[model samples]
Target: MLKKEQFLSYSAGAIVAGMYCGKLELNGDFFAGYEYGTGISPSLDPYFRSEMKRLEKEAEGDLKSYCSLARLMFYKGNKPKPLVAPLLIDKP
Candidate 1:
């Protein structure tokens, strides 16, 4: 069985990875442009916003699944493991 600390660490890492990936997918280009003072395209604003919302939802779902799996592992007495594998596995 994974130690408590190990499990917590795994969970934390998973959460951070999920959030970061989500952020990148959602606002990567916008943030890059904003940082470089590039003006936003008016025509693309709506599309960007819609895409961001979708990305955010996807990220949240990913995070929730990560947490849920972590909880299950903990309950099952499985050893604390890296977060990447679980996240990479497809879910139906």
Candidate 2:
């Protein structure tokens, strides 16, 4: 028997996976965009900022940290650029 929050967490993860699966191939920045977009929001700025403060006092996972950091990385209305993937190197 799954708890309500646990079930919701799994469902949320699945939904996010589905939404970004295609974009993953299309844009290298897909994951970064998703992290920043979902984690940090103008609507939730106060909450996010507070959560960040709490996290700073007691650091949370990478997702929210990325968004909190994004605030410092970019100006309002300007999104930080996506991180590029390293090229594959064939072993000799």
Candidate 3:
């Protein structure tokens, strides 16, 4: 029985993941034509800025969901989930 806010937050995380993936795919071509190689165009800059803010909001929403889930599980006497590990680790 997840709360409405929890479900909405999960959906927001999916949307943010999709948005970032799409941005990464287009960045190369979209940025290739920009002047000074800074990848910022007069027309695209505003759109990019807005997208960044949206992404941040979505990420915050997801964090809230995770925290809520963690708290719920803790109160239920369940162990906390392990943190996700880094993809690459250096050997000593």
Cα distance off (Å), candidate 2, residue 72: 33
Residue pairs of candidate 3 with colliding backbone atoms = none
lDDT of 2 by residue, 1-92 (tens): 33333323322332232233221111224334544555532223454344435443432245454333333332122234322221111122
- Rank ordering of all candidates by TM-score, starting from the highest: 1, 3, 2
Tens digits of per-residue lDDT for model 3 on 1-92?
A: 33333333333333344343222112222223332454334334454455556656755677655343333322222234312211111112
- Candidate 1 pairs with clashing backbones: 2-79
Candidate 2: residue 90 lDDT (0-100): 16
Best first by lDDT, ranked: 1, 3, 2
Each candidate structure's TM-score, on Cα atoms with residue i matched to residue i, is 0.28, 0.25, 0.26
* Tens-digit lDDT track of model 1 for 1-92: 33333333433443334344332112233233433464433225454445445545654678666445534432222347433323222122
> Residue 37 CA error for candidate 2 (Å)?
33
Clashes of 1: 1
Q: In model 2, where is the ten-residue run with the lowest total lDDT? A: 82-91
Give the candidate number with the greatest TM-score: 1
* Model 3 / residue 31 / CA error / Å: 33
